[model samples]
Structures are given as C-alpha cells and as structure tokens.
Target chain A: MMTYDALSFLLKAVIRFGLYMLLCISIYMLSASLRKKSPVLIVPTFLSVLISGSMFVLYDARGQKSGLDHRAAVRWLCEKPILFTILLFAAAAVLLTYVTFREAHLRRTVPDRSSIKESIDHLPTGLCFYAENGRVMLVNHRMNQLCHIILGRDLQNAALVWDDLCGGSIQPDIMRLSTDSQPRFRLSDGTVWSFSRTQLPDMFQITAVDITQLHNLAQELEQKNIALEELYQRLKVYETDVEVLTRTRERLETKIGIHSELGQTLLATRSYLLDNNENKTIPVEAWKRSIALLRQNIVENAEQFTLQTLIQTATAFGISVEVTGQMPEQKDVEKLFLEAATEALTNAVRHADAKKLHISLTETADTYRICFQNDGKMPETQVTEGGGLGSLRRKAETAGGSMQIDCHPEYSLTISMPKGGTENI
Target chain B: MTRVLIVEDAPMDRQLLELYVKQSGQYELVPSVESAAFAEFCCRTTRVDLILMDVCTSLYANGIDAAEKIKQNFPQIKIIIITGQPECSFIERARKAGVDSFWYKTETAESILHVMERTMAGETVYPESTPPLQFGYITSDELTARELEVLREVVAGESDAAIAEKLYMSLRTVKGHIQSMRDKTGFRNRTELAVRARDCGLIIVDKETE
Candidate 1:
C-alpha cells in the first residue's frame, strides 16, 4: 500500500510538471509574437526556461513517485518537452535571419516605389495621379506647380473628382470612363495633355502629362517651312532675270563683230593693192574713205551703245534714277553704288510702303557717300529677315566703308563707300 | 663689248632673248649652243665673256645640272640664269651653284635692262622678292632668279613638258634642272620644291595665278 501511494503521488506530480512546462512554453510563444517590432526578449526567455527547469527539478526531487520523480529516466533526457520549445524557437530565428538578409540585399539593388516617385516629382513637365474611384490619389511636385499656372490655386487631390479638384467641371465623358482608360485633352491655353491610366484591382492610376511646348514648336517649324518656300520662289525669279540679261548681252555683242570684220577685210584689200601697184588711185581713195567711214561708224556705235545701256539700266528695277554727285572713276564703282542704292530702295518699296524716295550722292577724292531715304516706318527687325541688309552692310565694310540706319517714325538708310575699296578682297 | 654665249633649246624664246640683248647694246652675240655637251666644248676653247644660260637647255632637262657641271670646270664663268618661274627654291639652288645673277621674263622691259646693267657691273644682283631661307635656299639674297623659275613650275602643277613649253624649252632640260635642284635643296619632288619655295617666299604663288 505504501509503494502504491508513492507511485500515484509521483504520477500526479509528473502531470503537474508537464502542465507547468506547457504553460511556460505558451507564454514564451505569445511574448515572441507580441515583441515582433523588437528582438525577442532573449535574456528573459532564457531565464524563464532556467527557472522552470529548477522548479521542475525541485518538485520532482521532493515528490518522489514512480511517474513524477523518475530521476533515472528524466535526468539524462536529451528530449525534454520543455527544451523542445527552445529548439523550435532557435529554428525560427535562423529562418528569420535568412529572410531579412535576402530582403536587405534586394532593397540595396532595386529602387523602391517611393524612390521612383521622388525622381518623377523633380521632372520639369506637369504630372498628376488619379485614384481607382477617379479621385486624386497622389501628385508629384511638378504637377503641383503647374496647377497654380493653370487653375490659379494650390491643388490638393483630396477628392479625386475632376470638377471639385480642378475648380471646374471635368469633361463628363472622360469622368465616366474607368480608371484604366487613357484619355487626352487640349486646354484653352493651347496646351495639349495626355493621360495614361493603369488598373490596380480596386484602384485606378492616371498619369497626366502636358505636351504644350512640343505642340507650339511644331507650329513654329511649319511657319518656317512656308517662309522658305516663298524664298525659293524669289530665287527662281532672280535666275530668270539673269538669263534675260545674258541674252541681251549676246545680242549687243553681234553688232560689234561686223565692225572688226569690215576693218580686217579693208586691210586685206589694201595689202593686195599695194603689192600690185598697177591700180593705185582707186585703191588709195577706197582706203581713205574706208578709214573715214570706220572712224564715223566707231563714234556712232559708241554713242548708240551708251544710250541703250543707260535706258536699260534705268528701267531695269522699280527705281527712277536721279543724278547725284560725281561718281568714282573705278570701273566697278558704278556696280557697287547701284547695288547699295537698289537694296535700300527695295526695302522701302516692298516692306515700308514708302512712295516718295530720295537718293543723294556725293564724292570726295577718296570717298563716296550715298544717302537713300523714305518716309516709311521701319519694319520690325528680325535677324532672319535682316540677313540681306546685313550682307550689304558687310560688303560696304569690306570696301573700307561704313553703313548705318537712321530710323525715326520715318526710315533713312545712309551708306558710305571709300575711294580705294576694302583691303581684304 | 662682252661676248655672251647664248644657250637655249627653244627657237622663239631664244630669238626673243637675242632681240632684247641686241637692243640693250651692252652685250655682243657669240655662237649660241643648246646642249650641255656643246656648251662644254664652247667653254673649253671659246673666249666667252658671259654665259646666258636658259635653265631649259637640255630640252626638258635641268639647265642647272649642266650649269653645275660647267661651274665645276670653270668657277669664274659669269652665269646669268633666265627663267619664267618665280620660286625661292630655284634661287637657293642657283646660289648654291654659284650663279652670278637671276631674272624673270615676265618683268617690265626696264627691270630687265636694269638687271643686265647691274650684272655687267660685276655686282651680284637677285630679285627683290627672294624666298626666305628655311630649307637653306639663300646663301646671301633671300632668293635667286632660277629658284623662282623652279618654284613657278612646281606651283603650276606642270609636268616637265608643260614647263618646257611655258618657258619655251625642252622637257628633258626641265627634268634635268628639277632633278639637279632636288639633289641640291634636299627636296623629295618638284611639288615639295614648289611648296617649300612658296613657304620660303621665293615667289608669290598665289599672285601668279590671279
């Protein structure tokens, strides 16, 4: 009976000890779960396990029964139930370390969503975001700045409704579309916009971009092309004028050809007569008459050529020639003077609408001055349109001269040409 | 009157030179020899006072080559180099060959007469616009007349035949002169000689074409 009672008590103690260990293990697991933000209370957990072990040892030693006080069996137990909790916890900690290492490595290599958003915010163009319910979700800094310029207020997409956020009603058709719909809009300021939509299950993502500068640049380029085509037409006209002049020159050259031919023929006849010496009187009289006729013909031809040349030059362009000061004797001086004067006149007639034109020419021994003026408003000076006049000015400078424009409500162009032209031919 | 030996390969240019020389009245004509071999014979026996050498004497060969050979045998022989080229390299080569004077055919008649008078006075006369001394063409004056001739040939981008025709001489004579010039100036080819001459300012290569 004594041994039986001892065995039963020992068994009860064993049960109690097992229940205590289970409770202790449950508490530790709970604490570990709660303490996820910090490291698990390792020191306290180890202390609890130690205390539990000491209590189990004391209780088992005191309550010596067959089940609970089985010292011979429990003393060398490498597989204790309470110790299993520690082993499980150690395995979990190792798994957590490996997971954390891999996550840290990925974070280092790949840019995160927030980091990409930050860069997009720094962009120069406007950018906006809309949510699943078509509400304003998030917008970058660039989009925020543009909102002031466009809507005249700070935009906070607290409510993603276009009418509420934009201070005006959204396009009804565009508002009704799903978040995944990409739509485009052109604003009153000539700004063109493109909105890209992305579907995120419950939420819609819309990125609105402004393409106004690109549209304006395209329009400017189209205008430039039109101007270039007009310029090409003008060049064709100039080519025709050159061809006409060349033909006229050829026609004039034909008449001069006969004079030289006649002179040569008369000389040949004279040589024949001189060799024979038998027919002298007729040959001498013919030679003298031919000589006198040649001189008369030469003088008349020169007078005719000069008269024709003057008429052609005066009537060539829309300009009426007025006698100015004495021009230079240099062969190319007239060419230079006419070119400079023509450019000034063309500008006034074509652009300024000036009907009255006055040109004054004066010359010193070493200098030539020309003043061409019109009571016309100066055209708005554009560098692109100013290239022709600029080239003329450069030509004058090359001839050791100067050019200036005096612009009042009226226009006056003054050009100066030096005597012995520019040194840098 | 100084008895000048006329050495030229072309009939027309030779005649033109004779006319000019006769008009000057400072020089008397001797037998005109056209080849280096004949020039050597004239040099050996004739009482020649001056040698009016056309660089184109070899008929498309270098007159400088023959002049150099003649100079070797008789150092005191007064050599007058006449050419159509205006190059410093040629002037330098002629100076090295110990030529007495140089003249260009395209100069005004008065300049030609002046060069003659100066040369007869036993003064070393060279063109005012001689090339600079870089590839060492100038012994004293910047350029000699002969160097200018070679430079002009090179600048014209002419073959020996073209140069002979332009200067009224033979192709062989021009070639010989160019070869001899190359040997003296250490130039690789006629082109190099021309470029170096222009760079050295022997002739206004840019001005000649214009």
Candidate 2:
C-alpha cells in the first residue's frame, strides 16, 4: 500500500501508454496501402475507438451508480480529449489506408517510374522498320549498332541510299509487293525477311531479323547450286554436240565408202570400153557421164515405161512367129522387128494357147505401125491394183509414147507411140 | 559331082557354108551370094544340081521367094530351104516348090554336104529330131525370106532402136518392119510373136529364161 493517488496515477499512466502503443500499432498496420492486411485489423481498430468512447459515455450516464466519483471521471475524460483524438486518428488513418489500397487495386498498377523506357534496349532481332523503297525509319538498338558498324552513319530515319549491310543494294524488285508470291531478301547477317504488301499495295514491310550466319550459308549454297546447274547444262549440250558429230562422221564414212566402190566400178567399165590397145586402162570419169546417162535413162524408163531391152531379152527364148510385108529401110528394123516379134511369140507360147501368130510392120511417110495377132482371144479383166500394165504404161509414156490395151477385142493388144512419127528410112 | 548354089544374106554365113562345102569334094561350090536375086540369076544362067536357099536375105530379095521363083522357071532344079532356125510352120511348102530338102544351118556339117550329094542322087536325108511334118497345107508367102531375117533379128533380143542402128536404118523404119511382121504372123504383140516363135521352134531359145 503505497500512497493511494500515486497508485491510481500509476494505473492511468500504464493504460495511457498501452493505448498510445496500440494506436501506433494500428497506424503502422494501416499505413501499408500496397499490401493486403488481415481482416482482424479492420474490426479491432474500429472497436478500440468505439469501446473507449462508449466506456466514457456509460460512466457519465450511470452517475453515482458507477460507485465512483463519476463527475470527476467524466470531467477528466472530457477535458483531455487526447484518448478520443488518438482513437479517431488511428481509425481515420486505418480507414483512409484501406480505401486507398482498394482504389489502387482497381486502378492501373504503378511502378518505380523514375527510369521508364520507351522500348526494349537491345532488340532480340536486327529489327528495323524500313520503307517499301528501302528507306530506314526507326530501328532497334541491335539495328542501330549494325547500321553504325556497317554504314558508318547515324542515318536517323535515313532513306537507305545504300545497302552496305548486305554488301550491295538489294534489287528493288523485292519491294514491289504483289498479291502473288513475293521475293525474299536474305541479308548477309542471316536475317531473312519477305517483302509483303502493307495496308496499301504500294507500300511494303521490309523487316530485318538476326539471320546473319544463316543468310551467309544460304547465299553460299545458292552460289554452289547455280554453278552446278550451269555445269550440268554445259554437259548436256556437250553430249548432244558429240552425238551430232558422231552421226556426221558416220554419214561421211558411208558416203566415202559408196564413192570408192562406184569409182572402182566406173574405172573398170571405162578401161574395158576405151581399151583400144587391149591392156591400157582409162580414167573412170571418161565413162562416168555415159554411165550416169545410162543410169538415169534406166531408172526413168524402168520406173515410168516399158524398156526395149526386156523385149529383146524375150527374143532369146524360143518362140514361133511369121513376119510379112516389105522390108523397111530401117538400119536395125530387122533386129527390132525380130526382137519385138520374138517377145510376142514368147507371150503367146507361155500365156496363150494359140494355133498361129501373125506379125506385120509398115511404114508410111510420117507414121510407123507394128502389130501381132494371135489365135487365142484376150481375157476380159479390170484394171488390177498395182498392175504391172499400169507400170508399163508409165514406162511407155516416158519414151514419148502412149500405150493402150484392149483386153476383149478380136485384136486385143497394146498400141504404143503416137501416129505422127517420121520414118527416116 | 553335086553342083550347089548357096544363097545367104550374111557374108559370115556364106563363108561358113563355103567352108563346109569345101570338106565335100564331090560338091562343087559355084558361088555364095548375099541375095536371092543374085542367086536366081546364077541359077538361070548355070546348071545347078542343088540350090541352098537361105531363110532370109537382103531387103531387095529373099531366099524362100527366090527358091519358089526358080522352081517355077526351072522345073528340073531341086531346092533345099536352109536357115539358122526354123522361123515358121512351113507345111508342104517344099513339096509345092519342088524343094528336095530342108536343112538347118546348125545341123548341116561337112558330112551334110556329101549327104546333099547323095540326096541329089535320089536319097532322102532328114534330121534326127524334126517336128515339121504337116500333112500337106499351104503356107502362103507366109513370110518373105527377108521378113524371116528381120524376125530372126527380133528373136535375137535386139531393140528396135538398136537393131535400126545395126542395120543402118532409122527407128521408124525398124518399127515399120516390126509392124509388117506382126500383121503377117497374126500376133497381138511382140510377146506373143516371141512365144509363138519359141513354141514352133522357129528359133532356138531358153524358154524358161525368157
């Protein structure tokens, strides 16, 4: 039992100190507006102020019933206003802090804006927005560094007058955007980008990317492929040329062989014909023209007309025939008549079962006539396909003569050579 | 001795006959002329035992024509038709002309000259393989001797142009000769003429080859 007032004052000091400490704690907890505090803190701060005020009010209402000197307590509590102010300040501070934090949560976040940046410092790629005409606008730091190192100029928003980065000006055709497939540009830095139409067809997006090493590899590969293609085409051309040359050589060889054989035969014929001294040889050219003429005649006559030699040859066979009329003044009329008659005789014997055959020849002033009549009648036949007679007719026409045949007549035969021929006998 | 007259158009043929006649001393070679006209003149002027008539002769005269004419004038003279090849089926023509024989130039030899002498003395000599034994038909101047010669040339396989040149005549003349031959023989064409000549043995030929 120390002094009574001292004990009471000591008790008041302890409670006041506890309340100030608690208010300080509340201020400290509510002041953290950025952090989410426990829900317990809201009620506790409100109750602390409410309870302290209510206690002061209750004591005043009870008067003497409080069993203490209420007047003095009430008057003391009212005169200080410190405890109420402290509780109000603590509650206001906490409530203001909670509202501030709730508003902050709904609004945009705030950062330490002291060092805000407009864009990335060093872009991931060598990205630069160039104009469709290869004009550089703004670029990232990586592009900036590349431009400085490659072009050696700040070139702020510079229309790319040159393409030093790619070692040369890229063909502007890439920038010609079209709806179809576009051209792709691979920079030396391996940055690959395709030129595409922008919002406007006239404009394009020529973006760069860090494909330096890739571009180099692709360019090297393209060069090697081009060289290989050129070599392949050259080889193909060479092969064709070689084949042509081989064919030419073969044709020349064949011609040479034919010429040599022809020359030898011609030489032999010439030597035989010109051998007045028996053993002397003659040049082939001497008879070559005659042989050529004969050959031409033979081919032409054989193809178009019946040849006289074939008739002559027929005469060599056995055939019976009788001839009459005056002996003409033909130098070889006798031989010709005999040959023709012999051929007629051969045909009659081989083809016709004739009893007898009559032959006659006559010569007028300008016309000559020849005929052979057999006992057997001619056969009635149509013109056959690929007829020998047709071919013979062709041959006869070649000798300036016309031929006709009457298959079923009493005098069925072929009469050749027109009537208007001079008899130079 | 059998006096024989040889009428041949070719000099070579006359020479060959004369050479064969030389081997037969019994036969006297009077002369080997080239034409029937000359042979006829000789026959009329001289007394010949036998006349050798060639089947063909020059353009002006023919041996067969000459033989027929001589037989008409000289009734006692014997004519023998001689030819390189039988050119026609001359049936009974010799009998009508009073010809004693028909001889082939290929078959007749030096011994044939003696045979002719015996023939002139009334001995019948004929070829071993002869087929012209017609029972007695007349072959009109079926073919003139010269015409026969021309026909033979045709059978020899010479072209009209070539033959005309060989005979020293133009092609037209040769064609005329051929036309006349065809007319007389009743042949439609040369092939028929040659075949007939071969079938009748008017000329020797390789039938298969032709």
Best by lDDT: 1
- Candidate 1 to truth, TM: 0.27
Tally clashes: model 2. 71
Locate the minimum summed-lDDT window of 10 residues in model 2 chain A. Answer: A297-306
Estimate the overall C-alpha local distance difference test score of candidate 2: 0.51
Model 2: per-residue lDDT, tens digit, A113-140? 3222234335564445556665654456
Native interface contact recovery, all models? 0.00, 0.00
Off by over 4 Å in 2: A1-425, B128-210
Candidate 1 local lDDT, A1-425, one digit each (tens): 12222345656466456636644674564465344432343444444455455545544554554455555545433224544534544444444444345445655766768877877788765555665545666677866654554445676652343443333544332322222344445555556665554566666554567766765687799999999799767645844464344334423443344345456557767767778666533444334434444444231111111212322332332334444565555534555555555455446555765544567778777777878776556667732336447766776777678887766555667777777664332
Interface RMSD of each: 28.5, 21.9
Candidate that scores best on DockQ:
1
Give each model's clash number.
34, 71
> Scoring each candidate complex against the real one, what DockQ results?
0.01, 0.01
